[model samples]
Target: MEDVMSLEGPVLKVNGELVLIIPLSAGGDELMKCSRGISEVQGEFLKIVIPEWLAGMLGIEEGDLVCVHNTDGKFHISPSSPRRVH
Candidate 1:
């Protein structure tokens, strides 16, 4: 199987709130499961979790390129990337 840079995860709810979880890895050695709102899984990549409502307002969808600016606490989502979950 071809290794992906990012993987899109299904939306789930915890405590009656919508959330989006994603599995991300850089060097393929470590796997991080990150989530928005409430997450049941503890993840190393906790920095990029985007909330569902904000994602919707920004038109962020599965496989979209989400760039997070940690310094200013802002993010930009682009629909140009065609990468998706396999």
Candidate 2:
């Protein structure tokens, strides 16, 4: 697996599988490039897209909540339980 751009975002499904959408304004493009991730533009935001292989490693699936940590420009993602803390 390849290193991905890091940021806090959900593990959502784009087509049928899991994908990450990292909201990064600066340095995200370069990071995505270096990490071999796809770049998507959402109006004014630049998002990083990593496929399900990475998600599979983290035991992440679509519809699951996640919190991604940025460690040295790498994606350190962790999935949260279905129960939400209100």
Candidate 3:
């Protein structure tokens, strides 16, 4: 079977600021290469500082829903609007 991973929910905040943080083990080197220029490289993870330019550009707001997708190690995060549950 193929290995696949996915997560859905809201963005996270650290020290009162929103961020997109992922572990190196999650995506390997590919994520680092992809996160360059937009994220800060910490000890074992890449943290993307969000909530201003990024959030505005993507129309993402605090408490907004988000979807996280991992494919072959790489990760993608997208904003989702509130939807009524069935």
Candidate 4:
């Protein structure tokens, strides 16, 4: 699990639809949902929050780094990218 800020506020909207935001480092195997959106925070960070069922389906747990992507009209998840060497 990677470190993430737990935000408590109104749900975020992107282009008029709500979305689940995660760090750019996050990745996943498959997307079980459709139509995700993205937004930036403070011009320097990204964030995400997922439902427990989605997390379980994606095998995501607390502290585990996960990824989400969009294809066509659906969203997918997978393990985060491998660390890059400097």
Assess each prediction's global lDDT (C-alpha) against the native. Answer: 0.40, 0.57, 0.64, 0.42
**Alpha-carbon error at 37 in model 1, in Å?**
7.7
Q: Between which residue pairs do clashes occur in model 2? A: none
Candidate 1 per-residue lDDT, tens place, 1-86, comes to 53333433443454554444443343212222222333334463333344677666666555455442212222233333434548
Return the TM-score for candidate 2, rounded to 2 decimals.
Answer: 0.51
Candidate 3 per-residue lDDT, tens place, 7-46, comes to: 4455677888887666766653345654566677788876
lDDT of 2 by residue, 1-86 (tens): 54444444566777675666654564445445444445565665555555667666666676677765445655455776544448
Q: Which 10 consecutive residues of model 3 have the lowest summed lDDT?
A: 27-36
Query: TM per model?
Result: 0.33, 0.51, 0.55, 0.37
**lDDT, candidate 4, 1-86, per-residue tens:** 43222222223344544435543333321222242342333233354455567555655455455544554545444646333448
Runs in model 2 deviating more than 4 A are 1-8, 22-38, 82-86
> What TM-score would you give candidate 1 relative to the actual structure?
0.33
* lDDT (C-alpha) at residue 71 in model 4: 48
Maximum-lDDT candidate: 3
Which lDDT value does model 4 have at 77?
49
Ranking by TM-score: 3, 2, 4, 1
Off by over 4 Å in 3: 1-10, 62-77, 80-86
Clashes of 4: 17
Stretches of candidate 4 off by over 4 Å are 1-43, 80-86
